[model samples]
Target chain A: MNITSYTARAPQLVQALEALAQRADNQDSASTLFHELSGITVLVAKKFTNDRTADGMHDAFHLTVGCISLGISQAGIADSNEAKLSFLLQHGAEYVFQMGFRHIKELSALPYAAYVSDFDNDAFIQQRNLKAIFLEICNADPVSVWTGDAVYQNELLDRKRNRKIIDCAKWLRKNNSNGLVKDSELDANAAISIAVIFAVSGDGCIVARTGQRELENLIARARETRPDVEVNWNDFLKKIPPEFQPILRERMEELRGTIVKKIFSKTKIKTVLTELQDHYAGSEQDIDYS
Target chain B: MSENINLPAIRQQVTELVLAGSPEHAEDAINETAEKFGDLAVVEVLNTLEPHVASLHLSAFDGGKMSLATLLIPPKAWAESLAYFAATWDEDWIEDEPEVLAESLFAHIHGVVFGTDDEERRAELLNEALATDWGTTAFAVLFSTAAEEIIEIANDIHNLGAHRSGRTTSDHDVIPLVLEIARTNEEAWDRVLFEIFPDWKPGENELHTRSEDDGDDHEDEEEREHEYAIGRTTKELLLRLRKQVPSKSSGPAKTGGRPSLGEDIFS
Candidate 1:
């Protein structure tokens, strides 16, 4: 089965990974094993939460098996190879490892690996030195350097808590200010903006406070400001249906009178996101918002 | 009396011609008889031929032969003859194996509705037919037929059905027929949709008239509500269809003659 199918069906695997991550620095007999497993989880999660391209998934899969093997070796497991494989398969590690192995085999134009030993020496290790592994991947495939750069850049930003959503909101606000008048462009950016806001604040309470009228006013202002160019005002206004218009309008009116902080204020953020989703939804744009 | 042609022989010949899959010849024979023996003699011949016409079992080969022959008869006489035929159309027995008879009957009604130049008379006959159970049955059969067959005369069909506006028989019954045409014939489809939803046009007076008529009749409020609901449903269906079936885009027509190869090479 595919890695995605395995991930979905096997909740135990995720729990075990999380448990290992929690005690990642423990000085017990399985300290190295725990760290290795934790390292693999972090790498895979980073690949998942950032760039979810096939290549990224393939890389995640490879690193997963490498660290899993390292963990088993460090723990001094006396089980037979077949038994070990069966245990790994049950735990959801085998799916990713198999896919990764096939991807590598196809790329190198080699026959299928008969056993774990058929894999290169670099495929297993005592511990995952993430930096060294990334550098090695870049050396083997120069195109992967960009992913390495992104990973390092995100590592710096990961230190801050609850900042990504606000940063994304600010970015969207800047984009909106720069005349998102064209229907297609407006819809795409708006969907992304809603998704970011939704991620930060659940239940859409923030948006309910901001209201529809303010967004309507914003669209009117944009159209009025640029009369020379064809800004589809009707197209923009049609984002929210007649049913939701009254309630949204009232909320926006309430938001306008308050001295609310911009991105941090849940009400203001929701107000913006709601307008964007409504507009995007009306246009039937299919970009992933969540 | 001796100079008059044999009406019985003419009737036999006309029947033979129609049964022989040659309604064109039957029409000619009837016209020749009228010209030679006068309208009275031709009428008597048709009277004598009535029994033969009644007994005709129209097969797929001769589905519309009798109707085509009826086109040769005078409109009033044709109408009277058709009335008798329709009264005797045993739907119970015919329904068992109704295809050929239904085709013939539908063709007869179609001719009456369209073959004559008189619009008022056509409307009267159509209204009469629609009011009767037999007529609605014939219409249902014809509606099913019209959907499968490509009726080139959609405009005439549209006009015939359009005459029933505000009548006891709902014009909404013709929706299936119009939609069927719309599926195959783009121009007719556009014509029908435009007729139904004239409000789509800017400054349309028809929709304004509807608004003005609203609340004028308190008793008809329920009927008006039902009609409004139907109208909404029709509009929604049409809009959905418009989304599904993209209209063919026509580019600007090129009227000029072909260009010569004598241009300044790079200019």
Candidate 2:
């Protein structure tokens, strides 16, 4: 359809989606709804490419995806049919725009056309890509959207926050001796135990902060984006022999202990230890300080 | 604009400029976007617009020279313009009589009929459009058909990434041929549009968009099924329109004049 039909059809599409969303209370209806929605969304992930480098492909796609996603969220609150139609067109444009992000290698058949040019898109894809980035950062090290300092500062703000969180935050703040902490906090590494606060804080968007789920997601996302990559997080771990389990565990313990230990009093350490007990989901035994 | 910029707000501001008798400013921004990026780039840029932007652009005072934005005005804007024209269509706007215009439209109808590969179905469409209220409305429906035909040609070309699959002069792809006829019919349309027609055969992966693995496994079976179904629906419509074998029972598609502002072709 041309712009004319598309514009006219958009409001009805949105209305249909809204109606389907309401009917989505049932599984069959939900499945049908998902199927229909997928039909429209897959249009966004269509094949196209521009003159950008291969390295720029991933970033550009995400940037466009983020922008498109944000455009959907900040869509005009439609009091009239016209406003509503624009909302649908924005959603369609997001997909059409996304076609510009195909990799050059896959795009050898495509003729070079100048695609959308914009500065970097640091959009708040808080639910998907950004959250994944945040989790992976904290998982690799301890840095997070909420670090130990952030958690501590968070505690100081609340009247009825976690008592254990308060104790841990105070213990963490005691180590602010050598560096200037801007905003009285930083996105530094949070303790594995402390980072768990956001992980299991009932936020479904963050699938996991660290561990098997996080590793699975990392590998899954990696493979989803680039299918040719040979990396497999599960395969690598599974290949490790059962006999070396205890030895690896001992080494792992050593690796886990070099945190703020000097002034990390028994109470603070105990709080971390308690949280750590459930951290591994009973795959390994509870780690002990004794 | 910044990465985290408010697209709606920027569009709102632009829309305000266009509406409050300052369309030149928005036109200037559109021109800048087109020059800096590309013509197709305007599609992404216009995706941010509020409603009624098209109606404002298509107005007599402003004119539809919306730079590259004219190439692909978001459908919402088009819908608004479609409505605007419907509401404001004045019979007195055209001095030519219906019979005289009908006679004039006959050759143009053949040109458009040749545009679509399936000439028989398009001929049937012309016949049906010709049967509309004394050729004035027939003229409207015929132009709509030509517009639709042109759009189909453009979309097919674009989906192929404008490659044309190494088919040079006299390649005789329906796309380029259709574009030629459409460029004649739509003389005032975007010039860039006429330049991007491509030629590729059916079942041939000329664009190489489909990887070998895609044929092997699709992650979401249901989604794949739905997508197939959606595409099948389009093909089904085409097949119905262009009946391969002329049967006694199932004849030419019985679709009548379809320029009823909000009438869904799919429906």
Scored by TM-score, the top model is 1
Q: Which portions of model 2 miss their true places by more than 4 Å?
A: A1-290, B4-6, B33-41, B58-66, B74-80, B91-267
Supply candidate 1's per-residue lDDT for A58. 56
Give the alpha carbon lDDT tens digit for every residue of B7-83 in model 2. 44446666777878777787776666666656555656576554345445534222213244444554344333322
Every candidate's lDDT: 0.39, 0.34
Q: What does candidate 1 score on TM?
A: 0.22
Candidate 2 residue-wise lDDT at B160: 59
True lDDT of residue B202, candidate 1: 24
TM-score of chain B of each: 0.37, 0.33
Residue by residue across B1-267, what tens digits does model 1's lDDT show? 853558778887877776677656676777787778777776676655553252231121233344333433443444334334433444354445455555565555555555555655555545544444334334444443333121223333445543332222334333434443333344544443344343334222211113334557866755554343212222232223223221222322222222211211101
Q: Write the per-residue lDDT of candidate 2 for residues A29-77, one digit (tens) a residue.
A: 4443344333323332232222245533443333333323223333435
Interface RMSD of 1: 31.0
Query: Among these predicted structures, which one has the highest lDDT?
Result: 1
Residue-level lDDT for B204 in candidate 2: 38
